[model samples]
Target: MKYDPIDSQLFIKNRKNFAKYMQPSSLAIFNSNDIYPTGADSTLPFAQHRDIFYLSGVDQEESVLVIFPDCPKEKHREVLFLKETNEHIAVWEGEKLTKEKAFETSGIKTVYWLKDMEKVLFELMTQCDTVYLNTNEHYRASVETETREARFAKKLKDKYPAHSVAKSNPILQRLRSVKDPIELEIMQQACDITEKAFRRILQFTKPGVWEYNLEAEFMHEFLNNRSKGFAYTPIIASGNNANVLHYIENNQQCKAGDLILIDAGAEYANYSSDMSRTIPVSGKFTDRQKEVYNAVNRVKNEATKMLIPGAYWEQYHVEVGKLMTSELLGLGLLDKADVQNENPDWPAYKKYFMHGTSHHIGLDTHDYGLLHEPMQANQVFTVEPGIYIPDEGFGIRLEDDVVIQESGEPFNLMRNIPIETEEIEEIMN
Candidate 1:
């Protein structure tokens, strides 16, 4: 991990909060993510499962965490099972967490090696009447690959058929959605790193620069700032490519008059910060480009204000659609007839701005939040509104991560990053 060690109190608090929601005599288990393979002798970098990290701050593979608040044995209330670390293992692959180190990292005293997991789990199962299994139930999830958590869940159910099964996802969704002070601080660091990268690109971008060149610049800045890199697959779309919505093929050279829409962010200590900014390739937006950019910015600003406590997620988007429709009408992309005759299912604004205006942003880019519930204070979200006009040969998107406040507007985490057209142009030039 490139980032510094986090204060264990944050994880301790998270565990305590989660325990409050669990059924009595229930033990919840969280497993680390599997290290996926790319090919023979090569594997992708290990990404810890966010839920486990949220509760235990164990950021390594082949780890397990069990929380049993009602355990008869006091030491077993919160437990961590880690891969055993030996001198031989340390020499081959860098030091894994020792028992003492695990305790320091997670604030849990009872630590066991993986070799003793079966015996310990058997003992725990005998004492607990219900078992909580961690599963992915994010609103946008479309997972096809069976994860480590899923595989463990299947085996646990098969072996302990009599135990009452419960889901940890619902509890996690609500808990993870609201930001603790420590989490907000970490997320701020992530956004600050992203701002550094975005500022660097402002000066570096120019006509004839390849889209991949800008991507590399962002990665360089992120690494220097102790970030692992992009929170998600970056979109460095130039010109018409921006209209594709998820364009990541950053292979084309930026033309003199075209606009580049960069939807990227940095991840620090497993926390994600999402940002999207559209700038001119030549350091100056044309009259038409400025018009579209400001419109999108206006929509983003208005949409962010709606993220106050008690705001409904679905209704917020509908209101944002109204804002976008007004902007599109002013931009001549939509007319009174276009809106009046438009299908209620697909608003006229869908022609230029199709995607949702906001989503929860945290440990995961599209973080966990139950949309049906009302927004709450300290819940972080991204307000991103874009206008794609392939006919005009450019697209414009402006986004920022914000924290919903107890009163008034949401606090913008990326406030330091330049978003205004004049500010971006001044920095670029």
Candidate 2:
């Protein structure tokens, strides 16, 4: 791993919390993600499943974690099964985690080779009456590929049809939503790396430069700072391209007086930090551009303040819409008539700001958190607001990652990164 080693205490605590919610005789299982294939002999990069990585710190493929908290033997309570490493395998594909290394990575002491999975699970299944199966129940999930976890779950049910199956998504959605102290530390590091990339781009951006050039600049900085790359598909939309929320085709050249909206992030130790910033291609924003930029910045700041404990995601967006509506009114994007006759389902403010204001950010860019549930302290979110004007051939968006606090306002993680018009202009100059 390019990132530094994380303390195993976080995974230990996560397992303890997950175990607390399980039934007395229930056993939970988690599997690492499969290394997806591209061609005959080529495969895409291996990314560990967040659920398995959360429960066990083993970040390798062909790894499995089982939590039988009520096992008859104490050693069998928490077990890890890893791909066995040998001399020839080490020379060819590098060293896979040995039993001793797996123990260091995870707190579990009973570690076995992956080949012994069936034998051990067969014994455990007879002893346990219920099974907690991990599934992708995320609200935004649209999984098409069959994951390793899903395949194992299907086989387990077929073999033991009488075992009561329970979903692990509910427990994980709540647990993973709230950040642990160690997780917060990693996320802060990710944000710090993103800040460096943003600062680098502020100086590198210029008229006549292609949008891909800025993307290269960010990748160079992120690689040097121990980050794999972007947490999600980066959006380097320049000029009218910024009007497209999911614009990622960075093929156009930046022109003077045009604005570039960059929605990019970095991942450190598998933790994500999301950020969005709009800047001028010529190092100076036009009068109208500055007006829209400031309005978006104001909406972002105001929306961040609403991410506090007990705040509902649905109600929070409503409040942020009101804040954006007032800003749009000031910018003359929405008139009195538009506001009075606007549909409640799609407010007038959405004409300028169509995307959501914020979303949970952690292991994944759009991390796990129940939107219907009340917000809790230590949960991290990205507060991003934008004003897209296709007619004017420009758009402006300002975003920052924030952590909900127990008291007072939410803490901004990207506070060190420049956001204000004057500050950005000063740095670009």
Candidate 3:
């Protein structure tokens, strides 16, 4: 991990909150994610499961965390199972977490090697009547590969068929949705790194630069700042490519007078910062491009204000759609007659601004949150609104990560990153 060690108090508080919601006589378990294999003797980078990282701050594979507040033995109530390390293993794969180090990292005193998991779990299973299991239930999740958590959950259920099973996803969804103060600080750092990368790109962008060249520039800035590169795949969409919402083929040459929409961010200590900014390849936006850019910026600003407490996720998007509708009408993309004849399900504004305006952002780019529930304070979200015009051969999008506060407007994390047309132009020139 390139990032500094986090205060374990954050994990301690998170575990306490998780325990408060567990059923009496129930034990909850969280497992680390698998180091997925890419080919023979090679693997993709290890990414810790967010649940275990959230609860224990154990950012390693082949690890397990058990929380049993009702246990008769206090030491056994919270235990960590980590892969055993030895002199030979240390030489080959580096030092795995020692029992002592695990305690320091997780704040849990009782730690065991992975080999002893079954022996320890058997005793706990007999004492607890119910077991809480973690599962992926994020609204946008479409997982097909069976995760380590799912495999362990199947093993637990097979062995302990009589124990009552409960889902931990709902509890986690609500808990992880609201950010703690420490979490906010880390997320802010991620956004700060993203801002640094964005500023670097503003000066580097110009006509004849390859899209991939810009991508390399972002990665260089991110790694130099101690980040593990982009939180998600970067979209360095130039010209008509911006019309494709998920464009990532950053291979074309940026022509003069064309616009490039960069949807990229940096990941710090497993936290994600999402940002999208459109800029002119020629270092100055044309009259028509500036108009659309300003309109998108205006809509982004207005949508951010609606992210306060008690706001409904579905209704919030509807309100944002109205704002976009008005902007599109003013842009001449939609007429008054188009609004009147538009379908209720697919509004007239869909022609230009098709995607949702905001979504919860955190550890995962699309973080966990129940859309049906009302928004709450401390919840971080991305306010992104874009206008795609294939006929005009350019698109515009502006986005910022913001935190919803108790009162007043939400706080913008990207406030320092340049957004104003004059500001961007000034910096570029």
Give the Cα-based TM-score of candidate 1 against the true structure: 0.99
What digit string (tens of lDDT, one per residue) describes model 2 on residues 1-429? 999988999999999999999998989999999999999999999988999999888899999999999999888899999898999999999889989888888888999998999999999999999999999988889999998898999999999999999999999999999999999999999999999999999999999999999999999999999999998889999999999989999999999989999999999988899999999989998899998888888888778888889999999999999999999999998999999999999999989889898899899889999999999999999899889899999888888999999999999889899988898999999
Model 3 lDDT tens row, 1-429? 789899999999999999999999999999999999989999999999999999999988999999999999999999999999999999998878888888888899999998999999999999999999999988788999999999999999999999999999999999999999999999999999999999999999999999999999999999999999999999999999999999998999999999999999999999999999999999999999999999999999999988999999899999999999999999899999999999999999999988988999998999999999999999999999999999999988999999999999999988899999999999999
lDDT-based ranking: 1, 3, 2
Residue 275 lDDT in model 2? 91
lDDT of each: 0.95, 0.92, 0.94
The alpha-carbon deviation from the true structure for residue 408 of candidate 1, after best TM-score superposition, in angstroms, is 1.4
Tens digits of lDDT, candidate 1, 1-429: 799999999999999999999999999999999999999989999999999999999999999999999999999999999999999999998999999988888899999999999999999999999999998888789999899999999999999999999999999999999999999999999999999999999999999999999999999999999999999999999999999999988999999999999999999999999999999999999999999999999999989888999999999999999999999999899899999999999988998988998999999999999999999999999999999999988989999999999999989999999999999999999
Residue 193 of model 1 has an lDDT of: 98
Best by lDDT: 1
Worst 10 residues of 1 by lDDT: 132-141
**Model 1 misses residue 156 by how many Å?**
1.1
| Residue 78 of model 1, lDDT score | 96
Superposed on all Cα atoms, the candidates' RMSDs to the truth, in angstroms, are 0.7, 0.8, 0.7
